[model samples]
Target: MSISARRHTRMATVAIAGAAAVALALTGCAGPAEKPADGEPVEITFQSWVPNIDRAVDAFNAAHDDIHVTLETITAGPDGGYATMLSAVQAGNPADVVQLGYDAIPDFLINDALEDITPYVSDAKDLFVPWQWQTGVFGDKVYAIPQASGPLGQFYRADIFEELGIDYPKTWDEFYEAAKVIRASDPDRYIAAFAFNQAPWMIGLAQQGGANWFVPENDSWKVSIDGPETAQVAEFWQKLIDEDLVKIEADFSSEWNADIQNGDVVTWISGSWADAILRGTAPETSGKWAVGAMPQWKAGENVSATWAGGSANAVLKGSKHPEQAAEFAVWLNSHTDSVSILTEIGAGWPSIVDTAAIASLQDAPEVFEFYGGQDIWDVFAESDKAVDTSWSWPPLSSTLFASLTDNVKAAVDAGTPLVDAYAKTQADMVAALTERGISVD
Candidate 1:
C-alpha cells in the first residue's frame, strides 16, 4: 500500500446548507426556529487537540444558524494541553466546550472549570452506553458526555504471524509463549512491543479486572498500588522484559515506527486509536496488520476487559449558551448522522449505543483493508462491551504517570528494589495530592 493509497477514505464534505437540509428532511416538516435571542451571534469556543474538530465545527455551524462555534486547536504535546486550558480558564476566557480526557476530568472538576450536567444527562442518558456516560461523572453529577472511546487490544502484523506459522494469542500465557517462539526463531525480532517508559500499558493491565490504582473511600482517595492484582500484573510484565521476549522502547516516536515497519517489532498492545497512528505511519504495511482482544488475566478474568482512552465533550461553567452547547454535545455524541460524519473524517468510534453505527463501520471495506482485513469494528465493539467502568484517575494524572514511569524505570533499568521504587512513587503521589488538599489515604 502506497502512502497515498493508505490515506483515509475521501468523502465529500457536507456543506452547512446540506446539513440544514438534511436536518429539515429528518424533522419531516420544516427547519428549526430562528435564534431565540436576537442578541450578538453567540460565538461558542470549542477546544480540542484532535484534527477532527474542524469537521465537527463545520457540521455544527451548518446545522444551526443561531449559534456559531469557533474552534481552538490545542497541541497534544508533552504538557497534555492542560496548562493552556488552565491558564485560559483562570483568565476568565475558557472555551464553551472542551474535550477532556478521562484522566484530566478530576483535576478540571477540582478547579470548578467543569459544569455539572446531571440535569442535561437525564434528557439523553439513554442514548449512550452506561459506562461511556458514567466516565465523566465526579460524584452524582455528569460533567462530560463521551465523544469517543478506544478499548485496549493487541495490534499485530498478521503477515508476520502467518510467516511464522502462529495464531494470535487469546490469553496472557499464550501470548508469552508466542513471544518466546518469536524470540527463539529470530533473536533480533520481538513479538510484542511497548514503551516501558510510559504508564499506558500498566494502566491497561490494572484495568484488566476492573482494578484501579485509586478508589473512593468515604469521600477520600485510597491507593491500591500494592494490591495483589497489581503486583501480579507487574510481575508478569517484568518477567516478560527480563526474558527478552518483548521489545521495550523508550517512547512512542519515529524510531519506534522504524522498528515496527522493519519487523523488529511485530505487535503492539494499545488502545484502538493506535490503528490511526499505525495506518498513518506505515501505509505500506496496510493489509498486513490485524487487531485482537487484549490478552486476558489467566483464562476467564472478568470477561477480558481493559481501560478505554478517549475524550469526552463537556460544556464549561462559563458558557453563556449552556443549553445550546449541551444540546450540540448530545447531538455530536448520539445522532447517527453526526457519528457518520466523524467516522468519515477518521476521528474514531462514537460512544453512542446505536448499533447501526457499529454495523455501518463493520461493513466499510476501506477501513477493514486499512486494518489488514481485520474486522476492527467487531474487535472494538467487543472490547467496548467488556470495558471496565471502574477505571478512573485523579486530576494530576499526568504527574502520577510521570512518577510511576520514573519509578518503574529505576527498578527495571537501574536494578533498584521494586518495593522501594514503588514506595517512593506512592510518597510522591501522596505529597502531590496533599498539596491540592486531596486526601491520599
Candidate 2:
C-alpha cells in the first residue's frame, strides 16, 4: 500500500535539509561519529520520554567499561514526541536507540527506518512474557523490545470504600453496584473519574474481551468499532456519565490532579504507569490506595486484560554503529540492574517479566506504604498475565481520536443518544482511515 497522502504531505514538509537543521539544533551533534577502540569507551545516544531512564543508562555506563549511553530527553507532545524522532530519522541523524510506542512501529516498518532485532532476540526473548515479546513483531520480524507492559486495573481509594462499607467488586455488575454505593454516600464526590475524552479508555475497553477491533481477514483488515462487545462497553460508560455515577474529565491535567489529590475522584481505571502518578501527585494519600484486578465480563471470562502502553528502544537503520546501537538496546532492556534502576526511580514498570527486580520491589518497606500497605507489585503482576496480545492501536489512531473527542463530548454533555453518537464515531473513523489508505471495511 502507498503511503497515506496526509503522511506524505507531512514528510514532504520535513525534507532532508529541514530535518538536518532541526537535528543539528536539537541534538547538538549527530550520534558518535567513529567506532571506539576495543578498550576505548563507546558512546551512543539513547532517546526516551521517561525522565528516570537516565538512571538506568547511568547504571549501564557504570557497569560496562566498553559502551556508555548518553541519555537524551525526547520532549513529549501530542504524538508523544514521535514526530521529532521521525524527522531525525528522515535526516539520517537518528539516535542510536529510541523509545517508540507500539502503535508507531508500523509506520517505521513501512519506512524501513527500524532495525530488525530478531538477531538479538534469540538469547533474551524468553526473559520477557510471551505478549511482551510479541508486541514488537510485524510479519515475522521484531523491530523493538517491549520496555514496559501496562495491564489495566482499578486503582481505588481504600478509605472511601471502607467509609461506604462496600466490598471490593469482583464482577462488572458488582463493580457497578459499588459505584452506586459510593455515589449515594456523597453526591458531590464521584465513584470514579472517566476521562471519556481520552482514547486510551476506549482502547482498554475493546481489549477487555481480548478482541481486536481491526483484524486481518484474507487480503484486507476489517474494523469492528460497532461490535456488540465494544458497543455494550461504550453504552455502559455512557450511562455511568448520564446517571452521575462517574465524572467526565477533559484530560489528565491540573483539574484532574486536584480531583485525585482531594479525593473527589475515588476510583480510576489505569495501567501500571498510574502507580507513579499516585505516589508523586498525592504523597499524603500514600497507603490510602489499593489496586484490584480489572473488572472482568464475568467471574471467569477470558483473562482479565486491557491495552499496554510504554516505550521500546530501537536502533534506526541509518545509524553508523548499528551493531553497537543494537547491543545498547539489548543491554538497556534486558539487563536486570538497568531495569531495576528505571523502576526504582518510577519511570514505568520494568519490561523484563519475572526479574529479581520484581522481588526487590516487593521487599521495599515503603512500596505499599503509599497504598495503605497494599502489595501493588503482586496486583500489577496478576494484571500483567491478563494482557491480550491481539490488542493494538490503529496506525492512524491519533486522527481517529481527534474525531471521537468532539463527538463524545457532545453526547455526554448534551444528552445525545449513545447509539447515534457511536454511529457518528464509526462513520468518522471509516472516513478518516479511508483517507489514509487504511482499509476499514
Which candidate number has the best TM-score? 2
Candidate 2 all-Cα RMSD = 6.4
The candidate that achieves the highest lDDT relative to the unseen native structure: 2
The runs of at least 3 residues in candidate 2 whose Cα sits more than 4 Å from the true structure, single-residue gaps closed, are 1-33, 37-39, 77-80, 300-302, 356-359, 418-421
lDDT per residue (tens digit) for residues 1-441 in model 1: 222111100100111122233332111111232354666566677877876668767877888877788888987523756777766666655677788776666656555566666786667877877666666754346678888876777888888888888888888888888888888877679886646676766667767844667765544567776666767777777778778887777646777889788777888877666766777778888788888888776676534444335678887755666666777778777777677666655455678878685444747676688776667877877877777565556546777878888887778778555545556777888787666555556
Alpha-carbon deviation at 172 in model 2, angstroms? 2.1
Candidate 2, residues 259-368, lDDT tens digits: the string is 88988888888877777777788888887889988877788663555443555778776676766777787777778777776666655566786666554465766667
How does model 2 score by TM-score? 0.86
Pairs clashing in candidate 2? 287-370, 287-371, 287-372
lDDT of 1: 0.68
Candidate 1 weakest ten by summed lDDT:
7-16
